[model samples]
Target chain A: MRRRLKSAVVAVPVAFVLASGCQKAAPPPPLASVVVASCAAIPAAPGDPAWDAVPEYVAVLIAQDLVEPRLLRLSTPEIRVRAVSDGSRMAFRLAWTDDTRDDLPGPAEFVDACAVQMPRVIEATVPAPQMGETGRPVDIVFWNAAWQATVDGRGDSIRDIHPYAAVDHYPFEAASLQPGSAPQQEMATRYAPARAVGNTMAGPRQSPVQDLSAEGPGTLSPVPDGHSTGAGRRTEAGWSVVIVRDLPQALTSQGDSQVAFAVWEGGHEEVGARKMRTAWIPLKLEVKP
Target chain B: MALAYNWQIGRSMSYWYPENRPKRQFAAVFDINKCIACQTCTLACKTTWTSGKGQEYMLWNNVESKPFGCYPLAWDLNLLQQLGAQQWRGKEYAGRTIFEAAEAGERVLGWRPADLDYAYPNVGEDDCTGRVDRGAALRAPHLNWFFYLARICNHCTYPACLASCPRGSIYKRPEDGIVLVDQSRCRGYRECVKACPYKKVFYNALTGTSEKCIACFPKIEQGLQPQCFVNCIGKIRLAGWLSPPERARADNPLDYLVHIRKVALPLLPQLGLEPNVYYIPPVHAPDEFLSQLFGPGVPAAICTYRKGPDDPDLAGLLGLFGSTDRVVPRWRREDDWVAALDEDGSQIVRVPLKEPVYIREAFDAQHQVTRTNCP
Candidate 1:
């Protein structure tokens, strides 16, 4: 509703021609690929000096052509990413501008999170960008701030987010007087398999990088040997997150693969399917000397 | 979501996932004829489950006087009335289920009850319709009739609450087939609250999440019955697991009562959720009223129940009501009786071959002499 046209706008391309005559600044290039430089040793953490070999890429908004478009959180347009590999392991550092630090998710709250996705099979006919196609699956290493807090030794207990929550009867706790005696509530401080029927509530697992394999939408399931991991920190203007994990099961040998990234802005109530992401980017591994 | 045949309702309804039988399901049956309208069961459930801060108005187990009562005001009276006008062909209820009514943005047969609807927990208690003159005698055929209808979540084989939740926070546990809310994942959208036609799911403002009856899973895990079933003073409630029609055994208490004897039927089977809670419709209630409430099965259920001593299965079925605190998983016919057995083959209860005759017989000389009145 608030706008100032500065001056009468000229019609069509003439406006751009005149604006170019003044020459303010050049627009950034479209995001295409993230170059993962093979390093002597992959950085175990984001701030490590060894990550400099990887070149930064401007991650533009994954918009216009979205398989499942969630008309929310389009504010954060471009993100900075750097990737590095050391033959056996891969890691990526992502930094995006976000004003608010949303680490704690309450009853109606959401938390900031990000994920890295790669085709389960190294190189095959392109799979659906939305997760993947059946038989042709995708490997995902997901990260969350809440889970990072847990990995940092400060348990992501419900009380940690909801300070006012007082629980007197948590029968599922390992420290309870009668633990393992009956079905129990999900305590913030502990993790217990949900007693919810069928496949409905199977999604509340709290591990940061619970490596998941998906073969299309709504078909995400946990995988064995999902040892993927990550850590996240909040900067003044945004968050700097680094995710590290060995190549997924299918990519055991050196070959060309595909990688994708998705970012969730918690301040905008973005969770689940309502986030931003890329379709797929080419990822190549160099041959051994 | 896809359309699948719900054999219990003998129709199709939208389901979010494929159907697979639980190894064991938590189920219950309530005999409305024997309910004394006591609040004991309600109190027992309240003290056990929904007595938390935001649960001031929550009654996970409520026994309301029907035809004139509902806790969330009318609950589903509007929906029932809407569904009532729908056509039924033979045993089929030809109408749109909540899933078919998807254009309206709800997956099941439901409507959002206004907040004011929940303001009063007891809206119509012991209310009757007709007003008679002071001198007029109370006629044999009363015009107004109401019955105590106790309710809890059905933990349905196909749950609308489970399908309605966009977040998929509601789930039915395969371990015991007890439907529950995962508080951690619930964003408090109230989709489950709106979609449960029974209006059993409640929204907790303090926790900013929805809550419902957990079926007393702790006690169930310990091989005990729920507090509501254990504390019923009228001895009219039976808690057990039901089997698919093909698998139901003649001796299992629930199987005999529901499938073999055909005396108990699921409430509103025409809605097609394949509800787990079954009810023995009040025998004296008008056929039209009972039929509408229990679906086309009423006449058969009542007829089977009234077959009396002639029907070999009647006594064993009738005797199982309120017989034990734990559900009998299986049964064995022992001569003239039925021994209800658990998973370990332990007898949980025994049903006699004949119904007990509590009336004083006119042929008895002691009764005739004591009364001093004979035909």
Candidate 2:
């Protein structure tokens, strides 16, 4: 029920509360201006991709508990993605729908994924840059269809394809690479674990000897909780390695800067669990007004 | 009114001890259907209780959408699967039952990684420090069949936080059944943080004390809803006093809380924390879809509800509709673990379910069907 309060009635009660509830009139406190950073100042790194293709067709892999793998174009169908990272925790929500909610039971059930499908291609405004900073944290939420396709104990089903998107962008420090956009095969491989998880339909089952080192500059550290550790450092090649429990806490800056590590209650165990990682690029601190 | 005056007359009264308790119980009915994912509840909690330093990541009131949701990132299912379907009948949260004790060969009461910051590292901060946004995307869908679980301290009937705390910093108030983390008395040993399966207890590095959702005692004491509820844009929440101990249903898990739709449920009752927060099943999705969101045995669980003609199981079907109803069901909702064993000696209530029978609507609209309570 929407209750639109009349101005007169609302004003009377609000005024009364202010007038009677005030124990004493207090002076206003000094104001503090939070410094705003510029996204333009931090340009993208070299060898960045240009938007030559207006609607770049990219294939993303989707993963869930257990289901077969498939690829969906990100362009034609709407690509929906969500990333949740509350410092200690991080995850991506991804979904999409076809021109018709044909497979949908109804609008409510149809609006979301209830069956397995392929990865989706989305038309996005990805900027050209080797890598640039956004002046804020960027949540990288990836949804793999396979992850969703897997069935639950109650045999609940989900759409096959997965989508990942960033919530917000912080500062991005791109690693220098040979001039070329990420190849379709390489991009697909990056999402191999998600594909595996969905294909197998086994929840959070990572191979014991899983090698998560290829994802980025990081080593997985096991927290007091059983979840895997997502702490690591980058080498000169920009490759990341997991931070061992016995590793020295402080790091020495390499070519650009040294990566520091902090752990929290969030962690995961899976071959693809290492896919979730947030990187901090090193920039020489310069004094500015 | 009389109880208020009586408490005022004796300001120093203590109700923490299990004995000498009243006959009332406290429960929370979370209309998963009404959760809008505004995060106003999450942030309201941050500003009120967890805004302190080191507690930055601690979301005492976190809302996670099912199917692909994870707080510390797929924490529970990952470990639970690893533990291989081994159910913890009593106080133990599912997973490897024994945690490593710093004292050699001496098993500590309860400790797990989900409670501490050292478990999950912030690769975003480490990689980009000031510039690292982790490049991760976080979103909550609207108008879809997603459920919003705004979690705080459950203030359990028998708190794991209280039992596991070596220093005894965590205590459940007898007066209103609100659980609190007494900062002044805490040593940051973090025993309570680990013991709590829900992972509500947190260690604030800046304050060097264990912190958690206080159940908003200050607001509760004033007869008002917590900040999260008052400021919730969706109006998907309801706040009220629960039944005190003696008045609670004999051996009925839901007797202590409000809004147990004979079919309403708790997540992973097998872990045995006796969580006070309860949920109404979202049945709009297919039975299979409902199971994934709720967990493995959801379909069978939903079938236990009795339905009548024209009843869409509105109370049972929450979360997905984006409507947070504060409605309570007529029949006493049962706890999932009521039939299981209680290992650690934590008191567990046993409420048996009627034969699994699903109540359907007399007229089935394409959008909804009636809920049937199992008789």
Candidate 3:
């Protein structure tokens, strides 16, 4: 069961533990803000043209694998985020440290993934950051390492993974219509049926970073929008990703909105409900003078 | 999960809860000799349930051409290979039952099959072991043999699905031992999928959850048969309450076929899950092959099915096939017909020893007479 923050008590136990005996109580979560520069100011390539104007907010997020928690830990739950929005588009650069690099999901195992969630609400009353509530939807940009590997042309094909495994024959892959055509995979013919069956093969040229929408738990679905874009590169520490989309209509010359974030370390076999997450945080936007 | 000594495997296996047996346990039997792989049962099941978005690849009930066919490609062959070979001494298994197969740190006894493995519904349909050993004489028209083995969730007496689910998301109904995955509670770990040797449990990618055949509880509660049971064109499937091993009934139809006559046996009984679905082995198939699939009941079941016409009691049981849509909990031999009764002694069916001379749907309830004074 997903427990929502009651607006009073949140996960501040770790913070409280560190600052005990000090006169001043634990400090509030750092605010993340950015100045929207001109579109020309942003570079074409990923991890390029560093913007010193964007304030990098290093904030801690409390994560627990409460859903049938076993060996996997919700560790390294901290993210350094910097945001910006040109007159036409919005963007955020996020970085987090993870020990082992997980780039495969296979006959062996899972890939690392990161996502950013926004309430999709332009103006008043922030929706519950726990992926939003009913009637309120959260638009998400999810970047999976496996999809990225496909983009980089580095992922192995199904046959490549299991050499000894024989695929003798697939009726769907057969040419010249056979006698009994079948309860056909009508849509599947468009894509290669052999690889199409698995979940990992998202789609061809279909963004490595997918746009999804969710309203509360179990209400997640891929949003049809292809406008949102993201790019990421793995460093020695972990991963640094840039998620960008059209600027929200609610954003005036200078305004702020709440956004939520989640990350999954696939090497630990984390997926679905097993993830590291953060509550609603402010993301300020401005057209820098 | 709990443990029980399954002497059939000479080891303890994950068993249903203690003292958890309901007033009556639901049992089923499929006469493989009658099935023609028509797929009516599959359609009936698919149309009734499992037609949703993520369920496109799922078949709650499936018919696989044996020897070279399996719905999830090689679900049976793969598991068997993983289990390797085990010796069977007469009636008991001398090797591991998955539970004992697990090494030091592993929690599960079986393997996790990737979703890609379950991609095609019938990977090798009707593909025979060989196109017949042509060198041999054509004296036997049936040479390279293949039989249709209809399968469904067995709703085992001890469900591996129930045991492997960490959050206790899977449960066996005490009323009928119908194994079910709690959709609301399932977090989609697919542990049940891995633990189930039969690969009956399926993971719904869309819902991010797991689902399985429910055994049609609503219909069962209403005294109607499951869709697969009533829709079977071959008239092979029978559903009713089976008596527990300790309280074996000599009169009940299920017990008559299983315990009393010993002509119908549980599929893979040595697996030790004690699958509730029983089968009368194919008569013409290789005894060694049938033995592996149905255990020591192979020769005996084949003998009884082949000479069914000679035995009055066996003939009476055979007459009940495709005759009724209600569950027959208890049955007895009457003067003219074999009377099958429900829990309250209501006559669900009465099949005569011989077909009527004028055949216009012989099981007409309006003209059917009930033995009101039957015990």
Q: How does each model score on TM-score? A: 0.60, 0.38, 0.61
Weakest ten-residue segment in model 3 chain B by summed lDDT: B134-143
Candidate 3's docking class is incorrect
lDDT of 2 by residue, B1-375 (tens): 011111111112111133333234345556565665677888788666543324445687877655445565554555444335543323222332222111221122233453333333221121211222555344433223444455667666556576555445566776767778765455344556545656677764323356777767666655455777667776555454444333444223344222233444455443434456656565544554454333344564455432422333333222111122221212222332123112232332323332367766775688577645658
Model 1 chain A poorest ten-residue lDDT run: A192-201
Tell me, by DockQ, which candidate is best: 3
Candidate 2 per-residue lDDT, tens place, A155-212, comes to 1111121112122211111243333356533433232222222322122323111111
**What is the lDDT of every predicted structure here?**
0.70, 0.36, 0.70
Model 3: per-residue Cα lDDT over A5-122, one tens digit each: 6432555775576667455866655555433444554442356766455567775766633333233455657887777666677777778898888765452155678888888876
What lDDT tens digits, residue by residue, belong to model 3 across residues B254-328?
A: 888877777888777666677888898888789988888888778988887888888887888877877899887
Ranking by TM-score: 3, 1, 2
User: How many Å off is the CA of B19 in candidate 2?
Assistant: 8.6
